[model samples]
Target: MQYPRKSYRIYFILLLIISCTGERSTNSKNNDSAAHNRTRYFYETVKATEDTREKIIYLDSALASIKNSRDTLLPLLLDYKIFYHNSLKEYDTSFFYVDSLISLSGAHRDTANLAKAFYRKARIYNYLGEQEEVFSNSFESRRYYLAAGDSSQAGRRTLEMALAQISGGDYLGSQETATEALSLLEQEKDSVYFSSVHNIIAQVYHERELYNDAVPEYRNALRFAPSLSDSLSILNNLALVYRDNKDFDKAIATWDEILGKADSKTKILRYEDNRAFTRWLKDSTQDVETELLDVLRLRQELDEEIGLQASYSHLLKYYLDKNEALSRKYSEELLKLTRKHKNAGMELTALQNLIPISPLPQTRSYFQRYIHLSDSLQMASINAKNFFAKIRFDEERKQEEIISLEAENRIQDLEAQRMRTRTLIGSLIALLLLLALSFLIYYLRQRFKREKIREVHKTESRISKVIHDELANDIFNVMSSLEAVAPAPVVDQLEKIYLRTRDISRENSDIETGENYITYLKAALTNITPRDSRLIISGETKVNWSRLQEEKKIVIYRVLQELLVNMKKHSGAKLVAVSFAENNKFVEINYSDNGRGLNWKRARKGSGLQNVENRLSSLNGKIEFESREGKGFRVKILIPS
Candidate 1:
């Protein structure tokens, strides 16, 4: 779901430096002593104010209060400004505030808040109907979020990106991006976003006429509905799906149920019109004309353009078979409304209806108009898709170019730091080099040992990089292109490949030997284990992990990881168990699986088994394997503590 990082620095040197400036003069300090509290009060008042101008006034005051201070309130105030101006349809002003925040966040090297700046800009562009900017900014926000390890925020950005793609007729990309968002949202259990993602997926399926697939996804959206309005919206979508698939009975039943609970005049009107149209479709003899016309007049009174489009189309369809004059009337009304709304798809539908009923001269004119508009819309749709593809491609290309520039920058920075260190050491050595030769020899020997340890970690990082850059990205590109064209089984298999490649990349990456190491290790093991198999882990808390060398811990992790991979691939295991124990000198792990046993005597050591052996050998560890023809596979590993 995530690409290889743009900031791939292998080393970090932490140095804290404080300026020697004296405390500020009280007279020179800003007027506000409690800047934080005052700014918070201003922000809260803005949130409570419904009037746009009043809200902006409070936001401006808050911004002025923090104008000279780089206090955290600066970005908070700017974000509020952007949100408020955007809602008032003042996009230029919204973008101005967004740019200000982006600059401030960048100056402070705050990637998290920088991501917010871009996300806010994406929202503004989304409202302006600029799909490319929406997708680009949303993706930019996601990159920063992923860099910060905030998957929940990254997922929200991705969901917005998916919505933009779908709006631009990029259905396949939208579906794939939505699914990726779901994966990022897996740990958050955020009902609102969960519902949004599934709703996106359902809409994609509905667009493709995969009604059966869309049905369950809508149900899933309903399961996570966070409010009554959201629930009613999803229920309306579900009924539409049923209606589209021609299961009219189910559609009408769903429509009637939601009609009872529909709280707003708009929703009631829409749902009522939908139910009446669906009933007419179910039984052409049904008399719904009176209800449909009344809804149309009400929609006209309200000037509801969207509702009127549906009403015009339904009335046209009803009169198409019986009343030529009425059909013509409705068709022209639909065409005029669609053109005014600038809805090309509905405009095409209106033209189609008009062409069939109009006189010869009008029919010819209508047909010509339809052809021009249809061809133009089709071309635009196709170009929109490619433009999006170009946007994504350009970003990947830009990232690739940045990789080397960043690497060189890091190298130069490191070299400059080393030069400073060497100069300091040179001065000290000139005075004491010969005086502490014995100590110098011991220090050099320890430095060599530390370098060797670093090499081990560097090697792990290289392997992870190879898997990600060489395998995962390439697989992702292939999946993106093949998603709409490839057979279902092939796509599914490729998806599995992508998942496994990512897992391998993560599994072989650097190990964290901190207190959370055990938690990460346990989660890794759980992830690799087959979902169908029951896994029992014992004595994980009993082991004295602090006693083990960091290198030894890495080896144990890799060895167990290999075993799990081998089990998942080759062992048809129903139940698997791993037990850990450690004493004064050694740690031992026993892994067993209830599956078709391997032949211990003639076990041709596979790559996975060999890798496990090599990792254990590097740590001076020992392993024992036991298996038979019809029994089960078992492995016991021992490493120095």
Candidate 2:
């Protein structure tokens, strides 16, 4: 019965569009100035009017006035038409005007107008729940916004994109987009938009059930809120997050603050209901049922469908364990309201809630409806994600094509320049010859240095093997022979020497290649892992080991071996998990362990860690460490494939 409520994403988008008038300006010639003024007056009148019918009449008058004017003002007129039709919920008419606006703006290369047109199209598609169209138009809008040098508009479009991504269930992508938008808005120093971005980020985290991460983001939103109403809305969101996180005291306190400031009767009732629910969570002895019923009466009196739906949902959940008849009654009411609103998400929840409390004869029908709705919702979500992915792929492909065309043009230009330079080639032959001789000398010196380094490594490997095979075995034999009579200190010293020699041997060992490389790597880790600890490996089988070069493999093997050795020596770890994944360009390895983590101040000075860094540097790779004392340790390594 814990329904995932829909956010006020559309409200924010609408607020942004209405409040941002700076982006609307006429760049038409003096000949059209009179028409432009008349159009602007009519548009302003439409915006100022509260009555939808009057707004429509003003929009029509503006469109009529501009019909005979030059095409310079056509884009603005089409925008008005689209906005009017959208407000009237005449989506098909809105879509037609959007198409007309895009066509007109594209013909004139009016990037700013085109951006607005695409943004309007995205908003229309969002209302229609056509998420694929929403994302496609949003991307186009963002591109045109950037082309128009409107970074603020582009940042807002990015927030819209993030919302589309969230609706498609791409939380990771949404979070990344939200972060990018947040960075842009911070640079712009626009407090209102910054708060909106923070709210989007918080919603992403909240949807992902990362309540701890969501809390600070909602607080940040509240800190930046421009108006008292906006602040109260953010406070309510924060309270909801706190309640979900089981911080009942904070949730109740936030609701109290909201109730004190909220002037609208519906808002006051909603906050009171929220407070009652939180108190019930803190202590079940509270009269949550009576409080919810009172709120329901007020919502019913106000004809607040959304608020009524919420009250019914809460009452249904409250009665679920106590009275099946009352549960069914409230569930039916919730379903009716959700159906009236055509809220598929809440309808799905209502169906789920009803299935359990339904009568035995009707249970099968309810189950069937739930399954059908769930599958349809899932498919819709999948289609939205696929459409967005396809749009991105197409965009990237077009960019690559443009780059290829530009590269060809550059090559042609360079070829023509080469022909012109042919006449001067003979004069530079002597200079070129001198430069080639210098390059040869440098290459020889570098090759000689590399050969010397190779010889040194070979010598070390030979000495290490000799110590490991001959000296280490002899020492172990001596220690075993004297075990009964040897003092404890002497035995300890011998054991330390044996371990050091073994480590040296491992450090100098050649990397295993061919088909057995992964097996060899696993064996190396197993040797160092403690018997009481667990080591889990995943995704190793997914990588194509043959694609990796010998040098990279050697570096990776050495680094992982060093980490395991360090863990075994110093960390009292109970569990370690390592996962490997590869994309087209990079092989990523994630390593984590439950252990006494590194002291960050001293971790950089460790010789073993330094060696790891050196090996990674040689392969042009990178390693990132995340750990705190008494917490778990984690390392992420990325190397070119």
Note the clash tally of each candidate: 0, 0
The sequence of per-residue lDDT tens digits that candidate 2 reaches over residues 1-641 is 12111332342233234334343345534435666678778888988998877887887677655523233555676787788778888887677668767766775678998999999999999998876678778899998988888888888888888888887776777788788787655444677887888898898899889999999999889888999889888899899999999999999999987888996888898898888877887887776888888998988889988888878888887888778898889988888888888777888778888887787768888788889888988887777667777777898899899999999999998998897687468557867887898899977765554454455457767988898999889889988987889998999899889888887787676657678999998887886788999999899998999988765676677788888888887788999998999999899999999999979659879898897887676556899999898997899999889
Candidate 1 lDDT tens digits, 1-641: 12112221110000001111235677535544566678888988998998989999998777655524456677788788888887888787777678777876776789999999999989888887888789989999999999899999999999998999898888988998899999898644666898999999999999999999999999999989889989999999999999999999999999899999988888999999999999999999999999899899999999899999999999999999989899889999999999987888888988998897899999999999999999998888798788778877888888888997898999999999999999989988875877688778877765554456557767877898899989899999999899999999999999999998988788768778878888888887888888998888899898988766676767777788888888888778889999999888779899999988877655545788887887676666799988886699989998877
Q: After superposition, how far is residue 227 of candidate 2 from its true place, in Å?
A: 1.2
What is the alpha-carbon lDDT for the whole of candidate 2? 0.80
The deviation in Å at residue 193 for candidate 2 is: 1.6
lDDT of each: 0.84, 0.80
Misplaced by over 4 Å in model 1 are 1-51, 65-69, 186-189, 401-641
Q: Best-fitting candidate, measured by lDDT?
A: 1
The TM-score of predicted model 2 comes to: 0.57
Please provide TM-scores, in order, for all candidate models, with all chains considered together: 0.58, 0.57
| lDDT, model 1 | 0.84
Looking at model 1, report the run of 10 residues with the lowest lDDT sum. Answer: 9-18
